[model samples]
Target: MPLVHIDLIEGRSEEQLRQMVRDVTDAIVKNTGAPAEHVHVVLNEMKKNHYSVGGVLKSDEK
Candidate 1:
């Protein structure tokens, strides 16, 4: 089994997230010969205020 973890800032539509996971799974299957059912994808969405860069929170930037 192959496990893939993806982290992104919150706000994407449900459909977009679903498509992202599907695309990831397809790539894994194509490259590693993993079965579709054996590939696991985990998506972690972070709030803008919870993510930061250059000492500034993303929510504070814009």
Candidate 2:
């Protein structure tokens, strides 16, 4: 089994998320020779207020 962890800021559409995971799974399977059924994708969505860059929170960005 192959496990993949993806962390991103919240607000993406469900379909976008689904497509992202599908593409990731396909890449993992292609590179590692892992079966598609055995690939594990874990998505961690961080709140805009909880994520920051250069001392500014994502939620506070214009």
Model 1, 1-62: lDDT tens digits are 99999999999999999999999999999999989999999999999999999999999996
Error of 2 at 53 (Å): 0.4
Task: Give the per-residue lDDT digits (tens) of candidate 2, residues 1-62.
Answer: 99999999999999999999999999999999999999999999999999999999999999
Worst 10 residues of 1 by lDDT: 53-62
Question: Each prediction's Cα lDDT score?
Answer: 0.96, 0.97
Tell me the TM-score of each prediction against the true structure.
0.96, 0.96
Task: List where candidate 1 sits over 4 angstroms from the true fold.
Answer: none
Cα lDDT of candidate 1 equals 0.96
